[model samples]
Target: MQKTNKIRVGTAAVLAVVLGVSSLIGFSSSANAAPVTINFWSRGAQADFIASVGAEFNKINPNIQVKVTTIPDAEFVQKLSTASQSGSAPDITSVDLILVPYFAKNGVFEDLTSYTNGLSFKSKLSPAHMALGLYNKKQYALPFTAEASVLFWNKDLFKKAGLDPNKGPKTFAEIEAAAKAITALGGDYKGFYFSGACGGCNIFTFAPLMWASGGDILTAAGQPTFTDKNVAKALSFYNRLWSKGYVAKSAKTDNGASFAAPFAAGKTGMVGAGAFFVGSLKANPEINYGVTPLPGATGGKGSFAGGDNIAILKGTKNPVEAKIFLDWALNAGQKFIATKAILPIRSDIAASDYVPQDPRYKVMADAMAYGKTPYSVAYTPLIADGQSPWVKMLQSAIFDGKIAAAQAAAQKQALAIVKKQG
Candidate 1:
C-alpha cells in the first residue's frame, strides 16, 4: 500500500487521506452497527424530498436511521448559526450553496476533504459550488440539488403571434422580435414579464444573460463589474423592450409578489424561470411552453446554478453515518433527485439518463453544461437584497431609463460594499 499524508482538522477531526478510510466507511453497509439515529435538518421546501431520501437510506441501512427535521427556510440561517455556535447543530445539514462560504469560513462545517477526494465522482461536482464550500483550500460541502435559469416561451402564444411554436428565441434580437409579435396580439397579451423589484429573481434570470456575453457581475478579484459593456448591453436590451411597451407594465413594479403570475396566467408570451417554475406550471397545463437557456445579446447561453449543498456540521455523533448519507446523495440517491426533474450534482448524470414527464426538464438539466454561480462573501448584501445597488441598477436602467448613470452608481456602490465586507 502507498503511504499518504494525513492531518486532523477542528473538532470533527475531518481527516486528510493517505488511502482514505472514509471512502470505505461511506461505501460499506451500516446494518451491522448498533442502532444509531442521526439528526438531519433541511429547509422547509426540501423537507419532504429529504425525508423520503432518509427513509430510503434506512431501508438499506436499518441500524443507521436518520431523523429528518424541517427548519423554516426564512429562519434557517439564524437558527443554524445559533445552534452551530452552541455546538448543538444537526448531524447533517442541507445548506444553501450561497451560505457555504459563511459557514465554511467560520469552520461551522466539518472538513470533508478526504471523503470528498475519495468519491469517484468528485470531479463531476459543480466547480462553482465546490469553490463556494472551500475554507483555506479544503472541501466542506457537496452540491445536493441543482437549479438553472431557463427562458420559457409560451408555445400557444408563439403560434398565435405567427412565431414558430416549435422554436424558441436564441438571441437578444430574436427575443425582442418574438416579444413584439406577441404584444401585437392586443387584449390581455404582453410580450414579456419579469419581477422588476426582486433581486433574487433577477440573479436567477438576468445574471445569466449578463454572463452570456462573457461578462460577470463580479470580477476575478471578487469585486463588482456592473459597468461592464456586456452588462450595459444586456440591461439596455431590456430597457428598449420596456420602452417599446413590449413588457407587461405589471413587471415594472411586480416586486416578486406576482412575479411569474402573468406568464402562468397565459397573459404573457415569455418569462425566465427555474425548475420550480416548471413544477409550478403543472396546474396550468393549458399554457403550452418551451424552455431554453437564457441567451446573450449576440449569441451563446448561460444559467445560474442555484441550489443546496449537503455537508456534515462540526460536532456530529456519527460522521461515518453522515458520510454514508452524503455519499449516497451524490451517488445512488441522485436517481431520485434527477427523477424530480433536477440536475444531478455529478456532471456524468444527464437529463436524458431518465425519462421526464415534461421534456423541458431535459432543457433545464442540460443547461448545467454552461451554468455558473457568482463568488462573493457579500452576495446577500450586494445582490440578493431587493434594495441593493445591483437590483436598483436594473430598476433604474429598465424603469427609469438611466442606463449609463445607473450602471456607474451601482458599480461604485457594489465595489465599496464588497471591499468593506471583505
Candidate 2:
C-alpha cells in the first residue's frame, strides 16, 4: 500500500474534544440513562455472523442494543446513496473497499481517527487493509475483513497434463507453459479462466500481476502510470493467453460473480480469484484444487487485498454508541476467522491459531504481506463512471487486435479521470 504523510490530526483532535464532553455528561446522568440503539447495515452474506457478534456485545453492555439489517450486495451502494441523501442512512454501515473513497469524498462518513488511535489493538490491524480506510489522510473507516486474490489450480488437471500436481506456477512463463500443456489434452476443458469483462474482477485478479511486474496504474500523486513499459508487458501477456485460446470462451462475457463457475464445474484447469472461490470448489468435492499466490512476470508474488470496511455515517445521533459497536464488531476476530474461513483484518488474530489449519488458506494469508490496495483517488472515479479502461484495453488488444492503440487510448482516458478527480 502507498503511504502518504498528509495526516489530518485536526480531525482527530476535534473528535476527541466531543467524546470527552459526552463522557462527562454521561457520567453525571448514569442513574437516568436509557438504553442506546444503533442501526447497522451490512451485506447479506455476513448478516448472520454480524448479528451473532451483536448478540454477544449486547450481553456484555446491556445498556446498548444493535439492530442489524442485511442488504443485497448488488443494491448496497445504490441504497446507501439514497439513504445518505434523504438523511435516513443507518448509524453504521459496511461498504466495499472500492466504494470507501467515494463515500468519504462526498462527506457521507464520520472521521474515526481519534477512536482508532484510542484502541489497544489499533496497531494490530493490517496496514494494507487499514490503508483502504483512509481518505485525505483521515481515517474515516475501519477494516472489517480481508481477502487476497490467488491462483487456484486443479491438481488433477495438472497430473493429466504431465506436470507435477504439487507444484503451482510461479512465473508468467511457467503459467503459460502449464496452460499450454493442459490445453494440449483434447477435451472440453480450458487451461485458464477469468472474467474478461468484469472490471472489479479483473482489477482484483490482474492488477496484482501489473504490481508484481513493478508497474502501477496510478502514482501516489494520483497520476496515471499505466503507460509504463511493465504495465504494457503485463497487459500483453494476458493478450497472448487469450489469443492462443487458452482462456475459456465464457470469460469474454462473464461478470466477476459467475466467472468462477467454469472452474468450480471442473471445466477449467486454473482460475484467478479470491478466497471465496474455496467455498465453491469445496462444494463440488470432485475437483482436486490447490491455491497459490498469483505468479509475477518474473518470479515474485503480488495480490490485491480486498474486503468490506465499516464506517459511521455522518448524521448518526449516537456517535459514542456507534463507536462502541464498531470496536466490538471488529475485535471479534476469532469468530470471523473460525466460522467464516476468512482472514481477519487484525494481524494478531490472523497470525493466531484461530485461522484455519488448512494449507490452501495459508497461500492467501502469506500473500497479505505484499498485497496492496489501489490508490483510492484513481480507483473511486474508475468505479463510479462504470468505465474500466483497463478491461477495454485488454478487450481491444486480445479481441480487436489493436494492442498499441488500445494502450495509448487507455492511458489517456485514465489520466483524464484522475485529473478530473483532482
Candidate 3:
C-alpha cells in the first residue's frame, strides 16, 4: 500500500475564522453543517506546503474540505494510471508540466477553457506555461509553479582560477574558457557537471543551448529535428568539452535525481540548474555561489521554462468546487510566490515588486523573459514512453564516442515515436 497523510482542522481559531467568513458571505450559518470532502494529489515533497494551503482554503470555504495525498515523483504517473483505470482517480492533481499534453491527449483531464474564460486571472498566466496546458486549442491545465534552468558557478572556485568571481559567463566561448581555467587546477575537481544519463535534464539544460543557437529539437509539426545544423553544432560543442576532460566523470552515470549533489558538495565549479537549486546550495553555507542566465552557443542567453500544472481529472465529481479552489489559489498571487520561492506564473506578479529584490533572484526573473518550452506535442511522446531517445543519444555521444551515429539514431527513433503517437 502507498503511504498517505490526511490534513484535518483541529485549531479553534482556524474554525472560528472559517465560520466567521462563511457567515459574513451568507454561505452557511449552522455550526453542525458537515463539509463535503474532495481528494487532491500532489508530489510527496510538497505535502506540507499543499496541506497548509488546503487548511487555509478550508477556513474560507467551510463547505468544502480538501484531502491531499502526496505521491512520490517516480510513482506518480504510474499510480495515476492505475487509479484512472480503476475509476478511483482523485478529483484534482498536480502534474509535471511536460506530461500535461500526454494526459490531456488521453482524455484523463477535463477541458477547463470554459471555466477559466470568465476569470480575470486566467489572462495573467505565463505564456510558456500555458503552452503546456493547451492541446488542439483546448485548455486542460493551469500553471501551478514556474522555474527556469540557469547557470550557477562557485565564486570561491572562480577566484582560485584567477577569474572574476562577480562575473559569470554570458557566451559559450566564455564558459569553455572558464572550464579550461578551472580544470587546469587539476585534482578531483571538475569544471562543469550535468546529467548525461537523464533525458529530462538534457531537455531542461541542453535543449536551451540549441534553442539559443537558432536550432530546435522538434519541428512545428512535432517531428524530431535533432539532425538540424544548429543542434549538431551544440552537440559538437559538448563533444569538445567531454573530449577535453572538463566535465566530471560522475556526469556519465548521474541521473537527474542526483546530478546536483556534486555541485552542492563543492566538487564541481559550475552547473546548470533551476530555482530549487538555490535552496539546496543555501543549505551548504560553505560553498559560495552565484547564478546567471544560461549562456547561448555564440552569444546571448536561453533557458528552459519548466514547472507543474494543476488540473481537475475527467472523473471528478466536484468540478465546480475544484474550479473554485483553483481560482482562489491562483489569485493568491504574491502570497504563493513568497511561500514557494518560485517564479510567478502570473504576468502581473512577474512585473510587480512582489518578487524578491535580491540579485540572485533577479537573474532568474530576467531569464524568464526569454525562456521557452520545447514544442509540447513532440516533447510529449519523446518523454512518455520511458527514457527519452534524446537522452540515449547524449549518453552515446559522451560515452561511446559516436556523436554522428547517436544523432542519426536519435532522429530516426524520435520520428518513429512522434509518428506512432499521432
lDDT of each: 0.82, 0.78, 0.78
RMSD for each of the candidates: 8.7, 10.5, 9.0
Model 3: which residue pairs collide? none
Candidate 1, superposed: residue stretches over 4 Å from native: 1-35, 44-48, 72-74, 355-358
What's the true lDDT of residue 248 in model 3? 77
Give lDDT: candidate 1, residue 32: 37
- TM-scores of all candidate predictions against the true structure: 0.85, 0.85, 0.87
lDDT of 3 by residue, 1-422 (tens): 12222223345657877777676556345654556688888886455366777777788888888888889766777888789878999998888777787788889999988876876777677777788899989999988777788999999999999999999988888888888888888997778888877777778888888888888878765777777877776777787777889997767877766767788988678888887677677679999999988866888778988877889999789988887778776777336554656566776775564355456877776666688887554563475334677887788876777878888888889888877877
Clashes of 2: 0
Task: Score candidate 3 by lDDT.
Answer: 0.78
Give me the runs in candidate 3 sitting further than 4 Å from their true place.
1-30, 44-48, 351-354, 377-381, 384-387
Which is the better candidate, 1 or 3, if ranked by TM-score? 3
Predicted model with the maximum TM-score: 3
User: lDDT tens digits, residues 1-422, model 1?
Assistant: 12232222332343434235445555555423345788888887575467787888889877778888889755677899899988889999887787787778778899999887887777778776787777678988888877778999999999999999999899999999999999999998999989998887898888898899777778755788888888988899889889999987878877677777789999799999987787778889898999988999887998988778899999888998888888888877887776665566666675435325567777776776578887676877887677799889999999999998999999899988988888
The backbone clash count of each candidate, in order, is 0, 0, 0
